[model samples]
Target: MTETLLPTATGGEARSAAWTALRRVRGHVALTLLVLTVGTVIGLVGPWLLGRIVDLVIDGRTDELLPVVLGLIGVAIGQAIGQTVGTAMVAHVGQTVIAGVREKAIRQVLRVSEGRIERAGSGDVMSRVSGDVETVNEAVSGVLPTLLDAALTIVLTAVTLAILDWRFALAGLAAVPFQVVATRWYLRNAVPVIRAERVAEGSRAQQLLDSINGANTVRALRLESDHLAKVTAASDKARQLSIRMAAVQRRFFGKLNYGEFVGLALILVVGFYLVRGDLVTIGAASAAALYFHRLFDQFNVVLGTFDTAQSATAAFARLIGVAEMATPDLRDGGETDSRSGRGTDGSVSLRDVRFSYGADQHTVIDGVDLDVQDGEHVAVVGTSGAGKTTLVKLVAGLLPPEQGQIVLGGHDLAAGASGSGHRCVLVSQEVHVFADTVLGNLRLSGEHTSETQARSALDAVGASGWLSTLPDGLDTVLGRGGHSLTPTQSQQLALARLVLADPPIAILDEATADAGSAGAKTLEAAAEKAIAGRTAFIVAHRLTQAARADRVILLEDGRIVESGTHDELVDANGSRYAQLWAAWSTHR
Candidate 1:
């Protein structure tokens, strides 16, 4: 089994990702900042005006009171409007940034090598695409905006307090050392804890997904208890990590509360002294107290957002890590689609090809040389682990041979253009029926194929007859929650796609292995239509399929043990093919 790829990034990589995301929505950021600044300035007027009104009343100046009150009302309205606009702008920037990240992630996923994906299993990729992406989205949409607002409010409040009275400002900021120490400690401890939590969460999700997707296999094999144990272990680990994170937060917040208490106490004590000394008027002292009280709330918000900020930062790092994955250029010799057309004929040639799952593992395919003429239907019959599927994958360019070459027509399969239009198409036993309309699924084969072309392809595969019975015909939705197709019907749909693709070469890896006898006949007929003009490789599970082939190649332990026409092989008294034929006939 292949190692799972974790979604994570180092500090520098995370910073780079953040910068890239911010740069994409610079306009929104600029507008939001401008509006927030205006709002902050306007909001400060309320407290200042309150102080002025108090002074006016003390001095018995009734004439100025009416205008000040009206001015305060106007400032309140402006602040409200500015806040609303700023919030909207912030949300727009957040959404845009996340959208860009999601797009990049998807593109990277598509570019990843199919062999790598198969080895690593679907669980890891699914976790990254669904779970990790969602975590990042929540960070952007919920935590990011709150952190920005809180930070801005703290800075503005600090400035206003200092301008009002230097002594009061000093007193209000007296608890800075405690806050700095606590925050530093929290950040230092919280980062690793949250990182662990994220990894645990991903593992838990992957395990659960695996259990659900392989439920049928688990039940058939009576491995339900084993799967349940694995899922429970993963879930428990995630729960523990979350609890640890919460405990760290509780400790950090306790210190913050203590700091708040100390700061407020110092401000009141200093304000009383300043007023008695006549260094500032009573109204100034009152406003200083109000500012300190308000600043405490804002400061609390700023500090409180740290927990969410840490989680968001970690999630964002994973998103960036995925987006930054290198997409390998698979084209050989720097060839482009324009430089090479489809192979002139579907003839396939393999020369001393070799491959193994790992460096230390025994070779699965070793120096196997074979050739199939254009429009020839060759059947490869072998028991499990004979490297039949592996050989087919090599021919389709889904995996590169470790040694020698495989060519289709005159183009080198290993070095030819990597585009879908230039390669052989493989249809495996487990054909995927996507959750889409029949037409939509057909169009996936060749995006430019028209509806008429799609219908023609379906008709060619003998699927059109059954398809016409669907309530919506080509428009009928299929796969999970939509219309369910039997194994034979799904195989027919896959063959329809193959027709639309129109590749010069095709490989069928036991494509009808899951079908019943009746269904198999229907599917075989469709398969015949699909392979009509193509050079086809059939990894035959049934001897009947081999009988229909132009020639039969019998594989044993990754070597071609026998090769001849079906009758010739059968007549060869002691050949492995003859023995297998005898057994198959007995079973039938």
Candidate 2:
């Protein structure tokens, strides 16, 4: 299968996401800006007072010097207090915006179709959810306060310089040309560098996870060295990209440093000539120079964070790209008022159903028609590539039929994008064990399910044996760092979850295939109990499973070759079902 990634969002989309989030919390925006303004005003007072002392010292006014020096101390204290409060307020606002964007991104990820996710590789999807969100969060909470503060300081300081002498302000303008040129260059080049760095990091993480997860296989096949080499190559690539990204950032700073050199020299030159002409008082010239000098630090703060800011912007765009993914419906099954999917007879019908992989690929499921009444237990049996799994997926509303529609409980089963309009669960051989407590994982099916109810469900699914052996019973954690379970136990745990979820429709696609022969029988019995009252479909490779079904359908190359009760199919001596039974039974 080819892996196709979700493209990062365009600049317009990132800006739009920001604008939307800000609009929702305008109250926070107003309070934060007001506090920032007050803090910047306090910052302006320090430079002016320092200039006053310089002038006072020239005139030898020791009587007034003490008060002015004391006042400078007061300004320093006020600026410190204001800055502390301002940082807190701005950080609060930044977190709020991030929370909003993160919420939208998660919602859209939830809505994405299985097909889109398969096409976008598991690692890429995981990267968007975890890595991109983390990058945006660090940039926002960490960089937002300083960046905004520096920007405001630069703008206000220039205004103060103009108040003292416009030539000082014009002197500042001389630096703007260099700064503008540097800024354009940095933005033009830095974005791709940072974006590439992030992508490399995602790839590295994916390679590491794949290698570690398949360690046993790697060792068994003597491919440990090969896997290690792949991991090393991925890590090395990420490291190189990161270094290159830093080089670009350093070059930006180098250019900005040149602008600072030019601006400071021009300001001093302007001040010297202005003093000679006496267009401004000696005290005022000092004040303007002091103000311009203060700008150097603030300017650095803004420029130093430009790369981080660009990274944040790119990360935000990636997150919003996730939010932008639409949940495609298999068909037009409008919203159903009944999430329980009750009130109608629990029946399903597939008419002339056809499905294929890509446009040019041979059909995986040719045109077919079938129906099963509510509470009916039907078994679909076939060899590999017989379209049994595809049929179950269509019935469970996981895949859409290419040529026809599926009707469930008198409503079209569209598997509505958000998983609304129908209540169903599809259990396959692969079961995901979340990094949580056994109870916590089970509660994901129904949050309000009581502990007593959870225990009963576990017992019903024949997990009581291991459940009792667990250190904490249902409360025991069962993920990566927790107690491990065998494949059989894992399937049992899944069956228990199905009992807890208790959806109106339950589909099992080789759910017991992972178990050993003895474990398979146990799981099959447990599965029967779990899906007792629900409309169910089981795709089986085992003939015993088909023999026990209320009705059996034998599929060959994506078409139903035989359909009947177990005994009826067995009675037909030369039939396909009979041939399969003879072959399977002969093996036993």
lDDT of each: 0.81, 0.80
lDDT of 2 by residue, 1-588 (tens): 213676678899879878888888888888888887888888798888887887788778767889888888887888788778888887787788878777877766655655566556667778777888887778767788888888889999989998888889999888888888998998898887888877877677777878888899999999999999999998998899888888888898999988888988998898889989978657777888788878877888888888888878878888887787655442323333353323335578888898887678889888778988878888898788899988887776666677887877667665454333345678998998988888898887778878898889889999888889999988899989998988888888898888887666788889988888999889999998988888888887577888888899888888888899989999987888888889999996
Predicted candidate 1 versus true structure: per-residue lDDT over 1-588, tens digit per residue: 214564467879989887877987787788889888888788878888888888889889979999999999999999899877777777778878878887888777765657666555566677667777777677666766666766777788789888878878899878788899998999898888887887777777778878998899999999999999999999998899889888998998898888788888888888789878888777787787778777777777777777777777777777777788765443333222331234447778999999887678889888889989989999999889999998898888777778988877767754435433345789999999999999999987767778889889899988888888999998999998899998999999999888887777899999999999888888888899999988899999778989999999987777788898999999997988889999999997
Worst 10 residues of 2 by lDDT: 330-339
How many clashing residue pairs appear in each of the predictions shown? Answer: 0, 0
TM-score, every prediction: 0.85, 0.86
After superposition on all CA atoms, how large is the RMSD of candidate 1?
3.9
* Model 1 lDDT at residue 507: 92
Model 2 global lDDT (CA atoms, 0 to 1): 0.80
Tell me the TM-score of model 2.
0.86
- What's the residue-level lDDT of 568 in candidate 1? 98
**503: Cα error in model 2, Å:** 2.2
